[model samples]
Target: MVTDTAFTWSDAKRECRNMGGVLGVPSSDEENKFIGQLADGVVWIDCNDLEEEGRWKCREVNVEVAYRNWMSGEPNDVDDEDYQQCFTFMYDDSSCPESWHYWGNSCYKITETALTWSDAINECENLGGVLAAPSSDQENEFIAQLVPDDWTWIDCNDLEVEGIWKCRDDNVEVAYRNWFYGEPNNAIEEDCAALAVATWGNK
Candidate 1:
């Protein structure tokens, strides 16, 4: 309910954590309504299944969700991102319209809007997938051919520990790498990396 702040679900939860609070999770219907009224925009709730798909945990207190207020047709497990179920509340209901592209066994989509690494990763999860990680060379090449923009975010990042890259979805180290020449010098504080459209468009 911090109106002065605008943040993605994960970031919002982190914000609350930093404040020695978890993003608020209403344990009752009355409290849910009160929280929804706290802001004109959707408010992030402390509930998600970042670790285990189909299982949700409260971000604040580690409790199983008992109360409920999901918008209709929600928790759809969209785009196969079954593990990304971060919850949010708006005075009115809201959902991100997902557009998907089938790639092998996975569905992929580059967000129309840009979000920070954490936010992007979270958003992708909530949609039932992780930010696309090409697990094999062929998958990488196929994904490379689908770029429609000058740049797009990829899930690999070294934010938690420099020089060690891992997939956001499972925290598994990347088994393959195709870094651009002298790439990942991390010339700036750009800890996040992505599949640059210009760099990977042709495979």
Candidate 2:
């Protein structure tokens, strides 16, 4: 029941958490309807599926899926080799978009009350949890809801070094994740990981 504006995806999420709400994830028909009526335009939801595929789950438990609005050719396994699959919504087009399709549209949840990505990551590491990777479908759905008209960053990255993908704290099992086509190219200078800002077709 909160309406937030004029803030980045990370900022908005922080605000929600401050009010005892970790972003809004509308699952049931009632929840969706209520969320739609409560807010306008693009807002943050608690959906993310960054860790494992086909395991979508909401940030808040017991939420039901009342709507499934994914962009065309969505949830594709193009980057399964890199395990970089994540979900988010684009206001420009009402389709289910993946990380490679539109990198910038991605959203993330903060485990701490920090403001920048660097700060967030540092806090997560301090707690033995490097941010959080979406391990369920509900997480993906929740992320899709929060995506505003801009690109955001998730906890996934290659902080171990550069151009080497690894989850928080250098977990070896994380190597078995997915990525988009021709992704993780690193491009020499492109060491850090970031969600693309342009749409799929444009990029």
- Choose the strongest candidate by TM-score: 1
TM-score of each: 0.45, 0.32
**Residue 61 CA error for candidate 1 (Å)?**
59
The weakest ten consecutive residues by lDDT in model 2 span 194-203
Model 1 scores a C-alpha lDDT of 0.61
Regions of candidate 2 where Cα sits further than 4 Å from its true position: 1-116, 123-130, 161-163, 169-178, 195-203
Give the per-residue Cα lDDT of candidate 1 at 190. 65
- For the record, the alpha-carbon RMSD of candidate 2 to the native fold, in angstroms, is 18.3
**Error of model 2, residue 147, in angstroms:** 1.6
**CA lDDT scores, all candidates in order:** 0.61, 0.46
In terms of lDDT, the poorest run of 10 residues in model 1 is 82-91
Model 1 bad stretches (over 4 Å): 1-98, 197-203
lDDT of 2 by residue, 136-181 (tens): 3434334444454443344566656766665432343433333446
